[model samples]
Target chain A: MAADRVTLSDVAREAGVSLATASRAINGSADRSVRPELVERVTAAAARLRYSPDATAQAMARGRTTTLGLLVHDIADPYFSAIAAAVVASAETAGLQVSLATTQNDPAREVQLVDLMRRQRARAVVIAGGRSAGSSTEDLAGQLAALRAQGVGVAAIGQPVPGVPSVAVDNLGGSASLARALLALGYRTFALLTGPRQRTTAQERCRGFSDALGAGGGVVIARSETPFTWEGGHAGMLRLIDDGSLHGVDAVVATNDVMALGALAAARERGLRVPEDVALTGFGGISTLRDVVPALTTVAVPMGELGERAVRLALTAEGDVVESVGCDVVVRASTPDLRRR
Target chain B: MAADRVTLSDVAREAGVSLATASRAINGSADRSVRPELVERVTAAAARLRYSPDATAQAMARGRTTTLGLLVHDIADPYFSAIAAAVVASAETAGLQVSLATTQNDPAREVQLVDLMRRQRARAVVIAGGRSAGSSTEDLAGQLAALRAQGVGVAAIGQPVPGVPSVAVDNLGGSASLARALLALGYRTFALLTGPRQRTTAQERCRGFSDALGAGGGVVIARSETPFTWEGGHAGMLRLIDDGSLHGVDAVVATNDVMALGALAAARERGLRVPEDVALTGFGGISTLRDVVPALTTVAVPMGELGERAVRLALTAEGDVVESVGCDVVVRASTPDLRRR
Candidate 1:
């Protein structure tokens, strides 16, 4: 049998105060004219009864819930999880709870989640995923606009959404720098492993790396467009190896760290020693991948800082504020100094 | 400028129907006797208005929110992230959104999160963390009891809370089996790297392995207790190595996968070869760690399934259900057969 939860009415009766006075004391009335002693008595009674004010009722009365909606492509991915962790921590510091929804990399699901957040009257919504261009993107933009119009705050990480504030990472510059570093290390011919062509992240990183390599007199011998996942990277690397595309390639560059890790596994399975047989590099220096053997060389994007900045942007009532965070290239065992050798 | 959101009254006005009829048609009346034509009219009007029902209002009317609360120790950790991903996916299938809270491994924070969930009127809660015995546990028990008294479903993973259902993995059995497998491989001397002593999951694992190893005439030369993190494992391993406790230890057993990965890094940094110089083993076969060089030997617990099952148990109306999930010992290259040598 369900037991009756303690109600504010019971607290009022116990405190010997009027219902209005009890409510004002507990929920903090705008007037704030209640006597100090009365407030203390009501609070003590409420504490004694262990009464918790219903958030649903409070949201209805206040027009917004103390909840932030966080949308991610996949929570299981270390990249997304890292961002989600930062968002949750920062939201807590602001006295907000986070409702997380995974879009499962589906654009339609992302749109649906934004609508759901609007329905929940969330104080803010933070999107942490790459943008894909299509009708789904249009639908997402429309839904986000509707949410914004309802006085809900919205911000994005990784990529910009129309009319929404965003914290953008320097993916292009980071990838370009990584390529220049590799070029200096004597990698003349490279093979590229990229995500689907529609993803702006993949497109930007690929273009930056290729352009920088070209400027430095290096060449791209092969390119593979695959899903932005570990399996995709493994399959892409295997395909390149089987097709003899890596025969003369001095290095392989993946669009992201997880993909680079998958490529490393593929290389090992194929009996190739890293940096000795061929050098490797990736974007996004995820912390979880730090201990992997032949530590991956990557562009260390501040993922946690990106999430924190996105939350701050969403909570702020500023218009279209775009904050750019920079990344640094970390050279590790995966990409040894070939020039010295 | 804030725009006025569409309400049920607007839908009723557009449909030229009574407010009661609109409510019954849109939100589903208990009798289900509303005329089909009336329902169709209301639905079409609502679609035209692009009206979405406010979840707060609905929750106030129904006395419960269509939300699930998921509590994790650390979302950035692969182990918790994998479980969280499954819980979110399963909750979504049940038409519930998940509000995630990280306790930061603090018992007091866990209690506070449960209280927050109670205030939010969550339909169910799935706790994915180890239990520690103390007054904080008592406080948590009281909070969970109050939540259940108010008709909220509750279930735990990894360890059981008093009178609550749980989806428990066979940590003891899994660890014992792993120890036996190592013993069979002629690993006679070992060192143990465990998490904090208060964590029930870590205690059970350590006990299981030690007991099994003792039965097999193998001795644990060194033991270290550290935080349940990768850094903890690395530190524990370094401490043991530096103290000369591992001078002749045949292998090191880390209580979890991340710790094992950390220990592997420590070993590599010390210029020791894996399996040749010292074999290593860990519990929990986290998928993200699959590509590590000298693939780690671990007890492959179905973390995702545990999460899914916990969600299922929480959602079910049945009383106090306990589900035990099994694990398998995956022998990888990290633990070679010393008997063969």
Candidate 2:
């Protein structure tokens, strides 16, 4: 069966050239020894034979595969999916294949995946999502350094990894802007739904929103920290509602759009009308969540752009740099102008 | 740097065993010539040295890579994302890495991806999505046949490919059932937003719903063909509404859930109240879409299970097989029981 595959020797025979010349021409060798006419003849013969160069052999020769590894927390989540999609599109333009791995939000699993990518000799790796605090970061930093040492490009999307180039979203600034926007909407008292303390993204967003609210002379009546997931938001909102935290609260702020959606669902279940009864706001304006009824007020982080930039930074950037992507505070029906009334 | 990587010889030297014995023990060679104590020593030595096997070398040696190639229409779409996430999870359990590629619903690109996967010597390839008609299908079939000839297993989700194992959803039956369920709700007239003519999934779904409606003495007053996407559905619905086609329609059926959500958005934009002025339904029970307000009435296709079964079939099946996955009609707030009213 292996013999059936068209090889450089076959192309060389068909093109009336030596095997070495065919290999040099087809592999685009840096040596300018192969004649143009011979290169053309070899190319035409390979095309005629429908020959595909073995990727494994190519990787062995190059010492790195044309594989861009993307590590995401969960592909099913719209946030990660959006990023993954962008990465795939960008990788395609660069003529690279994407090897996608899910960490399932497990730092150990993430470390293992990084090792796997390293072993595979992937040309580049883009890690999406926030980093949790602890030894996992140290372990990851070491692994990334090893990968970089091996000439494999590495980039991070969320929090900046010590010496790696990263595309960090302005989480704190975005959340603060969203908070000020909500304050302008005449929201004085609020309930907050935040994510776990270990995640830097959650912590930054929560602090930014709270600090901004305090500066605006607004108050956070209640707060609940849960997992960074829709279900977690739902449960946290339910706990707050059940504990009678919304009695005088003017609005509910969820740290992310998915969480805000879950909060909306919980509010609906409890017979609370959005904007009319209690206003709401969220962060990370995912486009897929656009059509949600009453429309969510959110900080529109350019999720896809983040992915594209990360891929670019990984494959092309020089030196350790932190590229910041800005966010816009999109005021929708979820948070209305109470002052106008 | 390549010299820095630990080799089998390093393990053999550390274990005080012959290179052949180390290779046979570490790679689990069929020949049981290596002694058990030597194997244990080699394994311990390899572990102690933190030696990660070179996947590229292993692939070349085995004539196949431990890669599961997954081709999806678009990963950003919740439907494909759901299936992709499942495929990744299932592949992980089998110790296979998923090489994801998006065809962007282009058959030429899909064929090219298949060729790319073949070049990579992927262990198995799972193509998820509907097939388009014409020369592209023949081209794809040829590519897939070539893949199988090289001992690479192949499986498909959605429409079955010739001489390949597939996990096919009951699209026709699901739509028929959905139509009947809607009829039971006392809806007499309907407007349909369908996909392009070339897609088998769209064609089957449209025919099933329309045929069932005709058989049940219900009428499809208007039908519009658009791209099988959210924007298409939105545009199709808006066109129908503007053209007065939906004036007397009791319900609107979009072939897929994303399309249905688009139609719902269009209806809302037109100031039409769901289950009052009109009702709406979508297919493919995407879990992410569960939070949409008014809740969607849909035929729940087990997307994750489809991916899991496809991986299993591609890797383990001995013969061409078609595994049918069932769909269930889920009644929700969008479609009300008009008879009660």
Candidate 3:
């Protein structure tokens, strides 16, 4: 079937040129030995024959694919979806296609994807979200070096990978701000729900919040390590409630919004009201959670901008430079004003 | 710096073979002209030199990219994201990569993306949203034909384009069922907040719901065309409320979930309670909306499975086939049993 179709040789025959000369002219080779009239004649013949050069061949000669690779923890997560959307938009404006991969927070998978992107010779690669503490970063660094050796640009969003440009949210600063605001509200005792200990974002947030509360001489009544999901938060909150330790804890500090959402569901199931029965504070200002009544008091990160900035940095910036983006502490109705009381 | 790197010629020299034979062996070409011992020698030499061929050159020789192209309306929209996640998962299992593009509901952009995918020689192309009613399908048909000429596979998720295989949700059937359920609840008058008329999904959904309601001797009190977004729904609902046109309307039926979310916000702004003040129903069973109290009554479509099935159909199916996936009508607190009253 392919034999029946018009080929580049046919175009060369029609254009009355040698195969080598026709190939050089039609492929737009920078050799300059092919005359202008010959290039035009070959191009017109190829157009008349409706011939397109093999894309892979075109890419090989050009040393880069007109593609960018995006590695996200999970595209199903609203946080990551928002970032993915931004990356797509930016890539579109740059006339580049985006190939996405979900690592499921697996370090090995992330390393494998980076290697794959290197083999594809993508124009750039963006790694979104935090890295796991348990993973071997040394291997990833080696893979990244290989990509750089092949001239593929690399940038990371959220995680600070060594030798890679990055745009990370100030997780520590944001959580500390939230803690101070809660302390100002006269919430002296709190129950904390954190994500997996291996997640750097969770660890940083936990340390920041605990540090700030300790500075204020506030008490952390109880703490639980939850998965970075609603179910994890719900289960942790349930455990805390069942342990009969809810006598005087004034608030629940959830490390992330999904966990906070789960905490809300757990509290509701136990016939407790937010802010009134027990105040709640969450990290990660996800837009989906913004509509909930008694809007969650959380630190809002510019997720879309994070993706856009990462792409921009990857495509233009040089060498292992890292850029940190700030976060805002949004005090919503979930934690009411204790000053009035 | 690149000049210092080892080239394939160096490997050929180390292997003691002619350039052509070494190239064929190292690229794993099926020509079978190179001797077996010579192939092994070339392979070993290439491995020792750590030589990786330029990816583009390799792709050109192979005649296809190990990637699929996915065109969606908006990646940030949870509906598309859910499907994208599923598509990525299935593609990974199949050992294929997915390159994504967002058309932003523009017909010209969609055409451009399809052409781009064709130029890239993607394994398959999936269009995951509605085609605009305003655009001429003739141009799109031509593009699809060109893709077919190149041996590229094509499939669509929501809209049905001529000569393209598709996996579509039963929008008409699902909306009709939702209409029946609402009528059974004894809601007499209704207001509809619909997406842009250019969108086929919105059009089909509107036709189905209105047709079913009209059949039951019910009236559609007011209808407004809005953008397919929460903001659009909110503005449309606000207009309806301000017009004092919802006087006897018992419910607002939105074409999709995002609009319903907007309507919820608009109603709350007017101090109107859901179910008690005015009932609401939405199509597209979004899990994010499930967490809301007075859980949204909607038609549950298997979003993730829709994507997986579309990919499977694209890769395996022959001819212009259209498969309709069924949807289920879910009853929740948003639409109560008003028949008893």
Candidate 4:
């Protein structure tokens, strides 16, 4: 028995009870048809045996584990945090618990987490992502298919994968509006700091900015690409300055708030005045920028709403599912005043 | 059968296999003298019969579930988010999965999550605080104790619970140094926007700030306590201004970055010059703040490391473990230049 796995039957045998009764005792069920002493016996037996209940079997017998898995690329960003919060709130409302896992933009981790969620027999899995520089998400697609084949519901945030419910901000529309905001403010020179190019969100944002500013009678633009992070923004802005590429650029737009914050810092270090000598803005309206100096003028996506929507869809998906959401722009002091670019 | 809770034995009977053989097949143990086709048969039957392995039973049989539950109050906060990222990284290294839930500082939610996590048969559970205004956590102390009695390793962030391992920041030391920084700069009057007074971290911060200022000679201190959030900070700062008390304060020390950002806006709205009229400093060196205008000088906490540590303790703990770790302060611009102030 020491060399072999100790199963539930062993515990039941030791406690002189049926397997179900043993389960009831370990689960702390209040009303079993057994004596209190029997409950105590089962409990002692379980403790002695060190039982870790089979999640799958319990889920099958108990109707559900009342648990869901949340998959994200990273959790440190306010954007994901916002969505994660919503997912938790919505899952609780539906009587299901959600657990969050960050993939760190690694598709291998993505596949591992999805598979683990399946093995744990989670009621549902909500997968969210940002940009990934390495590994193709084609495997995520396969995992989605496998889980669906096994009757597990799946939800996606960011890009809508086939056969999964999705919630996403309108990366293009938000980026376009931000670019238009900058253009209408009369800023001619523009610097861009985008997320990993492969990420659909970053790609859409870049496209939106280009269309809004480079279309028809648009102004001169100088652009550079940087990862969607504060460090990237800081370094990208510095690179632009060192290269003298920012000499004529009057405005800088980052794909996300972290990068924008970085750009703002870079500007400050160089003695550049924001919204006066240089206007700075970004996409995601993370909280840090909400109250910063010359509060960032950017788009605020309903991240919590996205997380909530994803969970609701995963819980209630009738069949193969797909959905999308958009974002709204918040104007603040960081953008150049309309009267002066 | 539909009304009779679906059982693994039912699947075994339907698949015409012995219980042991069925267990081996369903668990995907390929080396147990079972043909691949037979293994496939068992799994297919499980899916068809909706057999969920009992989570509690499975735990007893297996030493691991590859599932971990992370409990927190707010995922949107950068500190918590950082910790979450760290937890994910560590969990990946251990070949485990993470499940996250937010209590929103609500004690009832906290109770609900703990119960759900137990049912899900998580190997470890990590609880971070939620702002509980109505329901007292005094009731939760019992629930947590019961979980401990169940033999599940639990870890926490912020403050330690009895017999549970927790990761805590050096709130007193960090706040003390921040206050002293401004005091050394000869700032006599201070407006302090603090976090929820009920939280242990916030209490320590208050004590530290008071102690620092007291050592430098008594100074007039105007303070307001609010929940840690952007709106709370903004409203708290506004209150100081409307009360005509802000003029008497030369600097503001907020307990968190979000609140500090709010204070910055309040200062701007009140036409008070930053660093010129009232130097502002905040706790939590968030990535988003790196972009704020004039930047914020504050203490940076390794939120990610905290998350990782909490998870590690929970995963590796043996019996009745309690642990604490110190936090380093990250200096930012929110604290004014000592010479200038």
Q: Give model 4's DockQ, 2 decimals.
A: 0.33
Best by DockQ: 1
**Which candidate's TM-score is highest?**
3
Off by over 4 Å in 2: A1-3, A6-51, B1-51
Better of 1 and 2 by TM-score: 1
**Which residue runs of candidate 4 sit more than 4 Å off their true CA positions?**
A1-57, A62-64, A131-135, A187-189, A318-321, A337-341, B1-17, B21-60, B130-137, B318-322, B329-332, B337-341
TM-score of each: 0.94, 0.93, 0.95, 0.82
- Higher-ranked by TM-score: 1 or 4: 1
Q: Score the docking of each candidate (DockQ).
A: 0.69, 0.65, 0.60, 0.33
Give a tens-digit lDDT track for model 3, residues A1-341: 14566777898999999987787786555334689999999999999988876555556555568899999989989899999999999988887889999999788989989988877789999989887764477678778777766677788899778888889889999988888989998889998898888889999998998999899988888889999998998999888888976669999999999888888888888988887988888887887775566678999999989989999988887888889889899999899987787
Worst 10 residues of 1 chain A by lDDT: A24-33
Candidate 4 lDDT tens digits, A141-255: 7787777666667888887776566776678888877777776766666777766777778889888888888763455466777777778888988888778887777777788
State the displacement of the C-alpha of residue A30, model 3, in Å, after optimal TM-score superposition. 6.9
Off by over 4 Å in 1: A1-3, A9-49, B1-3, B9-48
In candidate 2 chain B, where is summed lDDT lowest over 10 consecutive residues? B25-34
| TM-score for candidate 1 | 0.94
Candidate 1, residue B11: CA error in Å?
Answer: 4.2
Writing each residue's lDDT as its tens digit, candidate 1 over A1-341 gives 15466887999999999988887777664345689999999999998998888777667666788899999999999899999999999999998999999998899889888988888889999999898877887888788877888888889899887778889988889999998999888889999998889999999999989999899999998999889989999999999888889998999999999899889999988988888898898888887567787888999989899989988989885687788899999999888888788
lDDT of 2 by residue, B169-212 (tens): 99989999999999998999998898888898999998999999
The backbone clash count of each candidate, in order, is: 0, 0, 4, 43
* lDDT (10s digit) by residue, model 3, range B1-341: 14567777999898898877877776655345677888889989988998876545555556677788999989989899999999999888878899999988777888988988887878888889877664456677678767866678888898777788889899999999999888888987999998888788999999999999999877898988999999999999999899997889999999999899888889888988998989998888876675566678999989988899888877877788999999999989899999886
**Distance from true position, residue A158, model 2, in Å?**
1.3
